[model samples]
Target chain A: MGKWIELQAVPGARDRWVRAEPFGGTVSFRRPEMLVMVDHAFLGQRQPKSATASGRLDPAAPYEAHLTVGHRCTVGCPGCYIDAREDGPAELGFDEWQRVLDKLASLGVFHVALGAGESTPLAFLIDLAHYARGLGITPNLSTAGLHLTPRLAQKLGVFGRVHLSLDGAGRDHMRGRVGFASALMSLRILRAYHPRVGVNCVVTRASFPGLGRLFRMLKREGVVDVELLRFKPAGRGAELFAQMDLTTEQKRTVVQKVLQLARRYRMRPRLDCSFAPMVCAAGYDPTRLVRMGLAGCVGGSWLVAVDGRGCLSACSFDNTAGALSWSDLGRPGMMTPFTNWIDQAPSPCAECRWLQVCRGGCHVVARHLTGDFNAPDPGCPLVQAQA
Target chain B: MNRKAKTKGSVLSVRTGSNPNSSSLGVDVTWLLGGGVLVGLLTMVGQTLTRWALTRAKSKHGQMD
Candidate 1:
């Protein structure tokens, strides 16, 4: 092998690879698609270590961590959830992230996705990715690509996954007003550099209509992986929530369409943890869906996020008022305040049949709408029907 | 899951992922995407599943006989 990253499959340590059956042994992520015949396969892999077992907030630590490099964004989508602006704060520096990566590696975290309001300006983004990889943690990226140049794509050659943000197939749903042509060019350039490139579609009522066309557009570019992310109502310009939030019926429709399209196009699709309730509501076997990486409210469990200010939250959308800094909770044995976002779910969700699968839907969204972090996802039809 | 499986006493499996620099793009994932940092080409590299399991157990628990 000219160059390869070797990842040991430690129990409870999750990764992008299918660390379970239908794939094979969870140990050694030598290659994504390579096959190795072991003398005898381990009967089974260990489940993720929960607080009940370890009596610690994070038993094995989160398998994946997200790093928000900065908020300095040039493309100002009217309903931008992060409030990212051209002059937004650039709080975390290069050294701070390196230290953060060191902690995660020691804690057994194996995957990280780097997102920036705009990565083109951040010269160290690729180097940061390389640093995480050196620690056996695979690093991915999500960018607005408002100003992605061919030279920049070539520089990003080391990254295995680089998802470009797009609202829809064309001008009608594209955010950042980064016109349709500009978005297409960014996709082409990134695809040429890293063909495994994916698209992060911000799902809202406004963008859902053109989703079919968007899927087709991405497929034409040889893009095979896609993730449907909920359009969060946070940050500035959130006043547009009423116009953008998916309606009750629209939520189910979007989920249905996403699954249908995944099957039709032979695409590898992922729905954000917040979309778990809707996905389960469609009468599919949630356990079987595990093959597709479906899980509910992975925050405080399978994943966590660190922002530019060095704050760590259960999920990136978490805005629980007070903050948890890397200097504070980064230490082992400290409990993140986000624990209640999972352990103390709303009464309805706790009593709901899909409780374990959804973890009461999205705690951040519930807190944003109901002022109660334990409240069920406001968009959940299960809660609506019961109401 | 652009796969062609052959099972004996040992198990052999393949999913879909390719290098961006490679000219061959015949991979089609069955149920997963962006599996991991797969660096090997489509060429065969045969190894026993027992080694894979022991490596996993050793890594997960710090060392085992």
Candidate 2:
């Protein structure tokens, strides 16, 4: 049988927002807010998008959202990014969360990536998922999987995908540490609850050695999907950054390994936006990356993360950039400060050929490592090469 | 020769020694091609309708996350 091209709605996205793809992309907007992610754009079949379209700003609502319900953790992973504690920003109560959800829905936001220090402990996580599902807002939850109970998983089964946070294959990173696990047990529990389970691996230097094993383990568990996240240099990670972060060579090697595994597994190999520099380092075509909507810095465009207090920043990782609430979002010339540098690459990036695609990698990573939010991503091969 | 061709009024006729089997075969081939095109178009219409129906049904309740 021949391959059939599908027109699918990006989950929890506007019903009108359709993503038609494979390798190929072109995120074209007919109206200011309507984004059509289709291969026809990459196929050069779309009507010419505005030459100066910027592909960044939209006066309308973001298509995706990241909402951290609370910041209290039962099983605090080593180097916890949010620095959750009893004193940290508390979880929003259901009513408060409802209001935030209401505002997002009113803005026509469709998908919400739900998380916290540990989502399972939130008493109303299931209710929140049910509520978001009721509103046609997809809730993609991620959790530190150690404390998950089957009853909780069963309740969560109704909404959408629940990603368990697992680092490396077995016990590569701090196996005996606080709350992090290999997540194999959580995977087993969730697989029984829902078929759409996936893992989120926080990529570190040790993770490089186990990419093959991690993918192999996931594949054996009837899981083919995982998102590789860069280890942010924040919270406890700030202290562990020098010890845990990948070196430039390791970054390139892991990228190459991911590509090899992706081909073998026929998987998309989902890498976080911060991994864009690594992808670039692996010698992938810049134009292809752009056409693929693999443009590294989409925090301020496609999605933004809201903290428990309802402050909307560019994404989950961007903590320092000033944020705006729903009321302030539509101000005359307001844009997330972190992404303001998206088009206007800072310093060294301004001199690079692939400036537009990589966008100097991740801002938060730079801020934490180089003490300058505007510094070029330290993991980027170009930064090291330029040096 | 397998067959000889002659034209009368811009219509070419193929003649074999005793049977005009090639001419009948040509007619059958034309009909086959025409039927194939008609079937293909109908199938496309049917597939499009099915997909549209599925999408409508999914919008009400779909399998996704």
Candidate 3:
């Protein structure tokens, strides 16, 4: 009988490998190229190494669909990423949203994150969540918590997780009028029925200082996980860049502070992939970075976003460049051409050592700053320091 | 400050300076540059300076300003 070992990709470099043995085998090795599987035969039976696995990517599907079911939002935070407005386009009908869910399910997507501007019709959101669950896709939601009534909260019990946006400790001022109270009420209501409740905070220069207090509040409110979203310069957020964007020194400080706070809190910390370059620039070791769950930019590669209009973007923040409409997906090949476009796209930061993880930072930031999505992210500490 | 007051202060202090409590005068120059107003002013100054230099050279060569 031969013992089997599994090899996984290293943290930063995609080609590097480390052996992982499940059956208590202690064989340790690092190879320049990815190794599929190797067996050691004890009965003198020789077996050829499986080289076919090297050519194939992971069999598990890597894509998660972030679907914006509605375009209207009433909260109107100052640096709203989607620039969601109360008067935004009406939401797609229930049937249309159901069809979209079916298409995502057919594509082997096991997870879907439902989002809206704010004021998404509660009935439509509930129906969509039910439809997605029927297809065996785990449904999650991100909301501003404005219209999360008790009835709506009961309906949302079907969701796997609910992420409430809490930009700062002071809710009303950081969010909008009555935003703070509403979010808290919603959190309390959701906690009564939902087991997995999380907070999504946007990290900016101003809010970065108060994150510890914010985390303490979330922990008190029974939040199980916290996702620290990097502030991207897009939509109305671009207007506040000068005031909110962290400088190189501030970025280093922010990363260190976040790591410290995350360690102190009981909540699980997950940072946006765009912040990977900042961690590397702060001189954190690769092992520490990987342990922090800071896998580089998975945008266009592992995740994709579908906006309220059924338009596809590499990520939610990247709603501008290379966006494909829902009509485009109806074509014959089915996402092959889209995936090829994302993979074949040229980026100036492709030669950087951290390219695999950073993926040239967020495309939205690059496009906003230099008018070219292929340009290196201007906010990247490495890019800024070099320039 | 109490937690509530501290949070309120932070929210009200979303301005362009390291000292969130300081008056508007503490706003940094980088913020101005980001707003593009400074860049536009610099471009205008550069254009005016070039025109003035050309006028001076022509006068030295006995041409009308």
Local distance difference test, per candidate?
0.61, 0.57, 0.54
True contacts kept of 2: 0.00
Per-residue CA lDDT of model 3 for A1-387, tens digit only, reads 012222222222223221222211111111111112112121112323542232212112333567767667777778876777888865567777777777766544545678777677766777788887677556677777776777778888777677777776773136764467677887788788776677777777777777888888887887756667777776678888678777677776656676566567755565566666676676644432322223455554345667777776656676563457654432433344223333444544555655543556665677777887666778878788777
Which pairs, if any, clash in model 3? Answer: A73-A118, A296-A357, A297-A357
Runs of candidate 2 with Cα error greater than 4 angstroms are A1-60, A119-123, A173-182, A265-268, A321-333, B1-65
| TM-scores for chain A over all candidates | 0.85, 0.83, 0.78
lDDT of 2 by residue, A1-387 (tens): 112333334333455433332322322221121133322332233434542355432324555677776766655566777666556665567887887777666655656777776533645777887787676566667776656778778877654566777777767544223333436777888899886677777778877787888888778888766777777776667888888899777886766677678666654356777777877776655544443335566566556667766666677666653447644533434554555676567767888766766778887788887788778887798788878
**Model 1: native contacts recovered, as a fraction:** 0.16
Q: DockQ each candidate and list the results.
A: 0.12, 0.01, 0.01
Candidate 1 vs candidate 3: the DockQ winner is 1
Clashes of 3: 3
Candidates sorted by TM-score, descending order?
1, 2, 3
User: Which runs in model 3 stand beyond 4 Å of their true positions?
Assistant: A1-62, A171-173, A284-293, A321-323, A330-351, B1-65
Model 3, residue A349: displacement in angstroms?
A: 3.7
